[model samples]
Structure formats: structure tokens, C-alpha cells
Target: MNAVLRVAALGLGQLVAIGLLLFVSAGTVDYWQAWLFLAVFAVTAWLPSIYLQITNPVVLQRRMKSGPVAEGRTVQKIVMLGLYGSLVAICVVGGLDHRFGWSAVPAALCVIGSALAGAGLVVTVLVAIQNTYASTTVRVEAGQHVVSTGLYGLVRHPMYTGNVLILVGLPLAVGSFWALAFVMPGIAVLATRIHDEEKLLGDELDGYREYTQKVRSRLIPYMW
Candidate 1:
């Protein structure tokens, strides 16, 4: 019960932190686009976390220990730092764009972006549901095995695919086309992390090499 409460509090803290970053950087609370984006993001991100907490507490517990400090490998620590920095830049840049009138995204496009973000988060939750060992850090846990069914069958790194969508969608949802530039760094970090993670998985985890052969793609199908 305490673990569940801690997870809930942490989730709420992150949400509030993001909101503060957006509004504080924007210099005002009049940004309706940011509000709508936050609403969509909060629902899509939090509800699934709550459900996962109930259904798969172990994965949730593992995920709770995230960010660079939780990463075991030095390379993964760097990758996580880069990834987190880029995510922060996305929010900060988006808010600044709003404050300076840098980009005038249409309401329809913002709605589309919200949908994309929501869908991406849902994909991440589904991946967690299908794979019990989907920890936030890039490490194989004790008793971990290759997950080749469901989303894993579609792509070796479905979670990263979902992250890519979220990164792309965040700025547009906040009505800042200029902020989309920040997404590239996050994607690049994800790619680097994937390369390192796959190498580790192939060498350390049993059957992972064969599963990689069967999956064939990391983030996308037929093209990657």
C-alpha cells in the first residue's frame, strides 16, 4: 500500500512539474492549448499507471526507480540523461514558443497531436501489460526472458516507438510548431539507447538473440 501511494505521489509530482514548466516558461496561465494538452496527457498517462500498479506492481516498482541515477550502465546513464534533458527542453521550448508567438498551430492540428500523444501512451501501457519485465532502465532483471509475443512480435522496441510518437506529438499539441525541433534530440538518444540495449540483451539475456532475428525491426515495421 505504501508503495502504491509513493507511485501515485510520484506520478502526480511529475504531472505538476510538467505543468509548472509549461506555465512558468510561458509567463502566463492563459494558454488553452497547453491546458488541453496537459489534460489529455494526464488522463492517458496516469490512468494506465494506476491500472498497472494494481495488475503489475513489480513492473511499476521497477519503473519507479528511473532517471540517470537508476541506470546501472554508464552508457545507459548518459543516454537517460540525454533523453531526460531533451524532454525538458521540449516543454521549455514549447512554452517559450507560446510566449513569443513563434508558431501558430491550428486548433485541428493541436487536436490531432493530442490524439497522437494519447495513442502513444496507450501503446506504452499495452507494452507493459504484455511484458512483465519492461523496466524503465535498460537492464535485464533476474529471471527475465525474451518477450516475443504481442507488441514485441511487431517491433523489438515498441516502447521506443511509443516514445517517438510522444516526442513528436508534445510540441504540436502545445500549439508550437517551432518546438518540434526539440524532438529530434530525444529520438536520437532513443536510437542510441536502443543500439546499446540490444547489444546487452543479445549478450546477456537468453534467447534474446534469436528473438531479435525473428523480430527483425526495432521501432518500425517493413522499413526499419
Candidate 2:
């Protein structure tokens, strides 16, 4: 599909998915937090998507890919499934929290969460702009090279850095403090995925090993 059409499809899919998920989980449409959360999530996600479509439609198309990486490793595939599953769980739990008043997340926290998600989206777009080979699946693309500039200079996995930030912000945005616990395991799984990515890059992409040495950090600066 074309880039514009792809973006439109994805955006529509998100609205439908979020609307259904929230309705199913919360059992009502009266939850203001869910509405706010969806708005923030949709706007942030689509803004970057549109930017990528304009600047690098090829990368956006690659990001839309659905399949295994080069190795087609089953374990990694399971981890990917688990990650997606956890994302769904997050919304469900958040809806339950809102329905039952499980946790009284303050308005301030929700605002902060929205800001963090926005920041994460910005970082993600920046990573995509810098690294043309940053596909959704973990693999070394044809003619792909290590991107040591911009955010990569600080963290080896800057795209994942954005993901980490989003994970932290999501629970609060959805009005579920307890859902934060769910984000941690996903982060750990992503760490393993990053390990697999780097291993592949070091073997297949020249200079990646050297870049890793220089950066030292994978998803966080001056740490990890």
C-alpha cells in the first residue's frame, strides 16, 4: 500500500482497536481518562507516523511489516507476541482500575504521562529519521549500517529507549498505577530482543561492534 493510505489505515485501525478495547475493558464509555489516553496515544503515534511517511515512506512501510526477522527464531516471535499481549492487558487492567476505582491516579500524573508519551513519540520519530534500517522486526536489512549519530551516540537502541519511556507513561495515562508493574517484564523482554538485534548487527553489519563499544549503553544513557 502507499504511504498515505498505509497511515490512514493504521490510524483507523488504532481508533477502532482502542475504542473496542476500552469499551470491552471498562464496560462503559463514561471513563474520561480512557478517552483522554486514547486521544494522546493516537495523536502522538500518528504525528510521528505522518512525519516518517513524508520524510521516509520506505522506512514507514518497513515499520508496517509483519513477520519474523531473518532468523525466524520462535522464541523471539513468542516474546514479540507476549509484548503485544501485555499491551492489551495494560488497557484492560486500566479500564478495570477506572471502573472499580482501583487506583486514584491524580490529574497531574495523567498529564505527566501524556507528556512522557509525547516525548517518547518524538524520540521514536527522531530515531527513524536517523536510522533508515530501523524496521519493526529485528534484522539487519540489506545495505543497512549502524547509525552512531544523534540519539545512537548515547544509546545503542534509541528506538527502544522511546519504547521504555512510553511503557512508563502508559499506566498513568490509562488511570492504572498497578499497570506499571506489567511494563517491567515487557522491558526485560525488549532487552533480550535488543541483545538478539545487536548480535545480528555485530555479525552482519560492519562497524556495529565498534559503535556499541563507543556507545556502551543500549537503552539508557550512562546506565545499562
Candidate 2 structure, TM-score to reference: 0.92
TM-score of candidate 1 on Cα atoms, chains taken together? 0.96
Residue 200 accuracy (lDDT) in model 2: 81
- The RMSD of every model to the true structure, in order and in angstroms, is 1.2, 2.0
- TM-scores, one per candidate: 0.96, 0.92
- lDDT (Cα atoms) of all candidates against the true structure: 0.86, 0.79
Clash totals for all candidate models: 0, 0
lDDT of 1 by residue, 1-224 (tens): 77667767877898899899899999999998888877887788876677678878877776567889999999999999998888788889889999999888999998888888888888887887888898788888789999999999999999889988889888888888888888989999999999999999989999998998898999988767
Backbone clashes in model 1, listed as residue pairs: none
Q: Which pairs clash (backbone N, Cα, C closer than 3 Å) in model 2?
A: none
